[model samples]
Target: MDTSPYLQSRQRLVPAPPRAVFELLADPAMHPVIDGSGTVRAARGGSPDRLRLGAEFGMDMRLGVPYRISNTVVEFEDGRTIAWRHFSGHRWRYELEPVDGGTLVRETWDASRLKHKWALRVLGFTRTTPGNMERTLERLAAQFDGGATPS
Candidate 1:
């Protein structure tokens, strides 16, 4: 487990209604839809279908090759908040809030105490790092703004 503090990103999007934004962010099945990054390979069994608190799912991504992680919903409130923690070791969280035009989404990642050390070394190569997370965030914001890029 990494003890270091996690990094976070808070973004606001306009256009997508609370219901639409909530559905897109809350459900795991929509991963590929808004996640233009091509990350989140597959869910635990297969499809996400729907999401609820305490629910667990599998995710795969390609930094350079491929990496997989399991995640579970830690907390959820309809059209309010949804928090998830990484189950595969790393500590991560995602929080969503309803806004005037759409919804505000925040994502965080923590890998402070990586004993592997090797993983830290690899992260040093920022050039080859994955942009899936960023791309997904942008897409969500755009989709929320009725497919318009927010300023």
Candidate 2:
């Protein structure tokens, strides 16, 4: 986990190969299945089927109010890491490391570049993000343990 002042991260050892996990991450349509925030409702039209660097995808989100967010893939390293940033300028990143039993997946929420950092911090997202990341990893791991990724 990153201990830096600007990022919150969580790591989990998932019993799935990096390639398999990467495939799921690269597909924007599968995001709602692994999202821990519970805000992602669906992938909207015009989103990419498989995301690559610079690809843009739109997600229907609901957090008391229904809305959509368009995110751009900011980083991609085939089977290793992927990150995206939305209009808010914060980044959501995932890193995968091959381990003995499976893969060590680290998910990060970076708000260092957020325009309204004080506002978000006041909202207590800083305290909530790590737990959400842990749940996200668990859900991703469950997808490999005799369970199907929700469609």
Candidate 3:
């Protein structure tokens, strides 16, 4: 189990190049196609075609009730890393590294900067997010691996 109080991450070896993986991550329109949690519905209007540092975008989402959220890209490193945060100050980050045969992708849910870290834990985010991230990565990898459906 992770000892970190405010962050959870999962990694997978994806059989794709860093640029290919980064392209998918940088496009908000593709989020729902790859989302494992099933909360993301679609990208809102006016979002940039490609995300960069300081860019803002909105997503239509639903956990139980439909809602919308806005996010800003807080970190970017071309094909290597990207991270975004919404109003709550937590971030969703992806880092890619070129390995021997493919890219090693790491997805992280970072709540280290949130004010109510304990609240998320109490709400079971800490317990549930890792599995969600793992599935997200699986879906991402599937996009490059002969179109295998991600379960």
Best-performing candidate as measured by lDDT: 3
Q: Which ten residues in a row have the lowest lDDT in candidate 2?
A: 142-151
| Least well predicted 10-residue stretch by lDDT in candidate 1 | 1-10
TM-score of each: 0.68, 0.92, 0.95
What ranges in model 2 sit over 4 Å off?
3-6, 147-151
* Stretches of model 1 off by over 4 angstroms after superposition: 1-5, 44-48, 112-118, 124-133, 146-151
After best superposition, candidate 3 residue 66: deviation in angstroms? 0.4
lDDT of each residue in 1-151, candidate 2, tens digit only:
6775458888898898999999999998888989987888899999988999999999999988999998999999999999999888989999999999889998889999776788876877887788778878888998888776432
**How well is each residue in 24-140 modelled by candidate 1, as lDDT tens digits?**
767776665666446556555663567778778777666568887777877778766666676535544556666775566665554544456465446652222224446667777
Arrange candidates by TM-score, descending: 3, 2, 1
Q: Give the TM-score of candidate 3.
A: 0.95
lDDT of 3 by residue, 97-143 (tens): 99987899999899988878899999888888888999999999999
Show the colliding residue pairs in model 1: 2-112, 2-113, 3-113, 14-145, 15-145, 16-144, 44-58
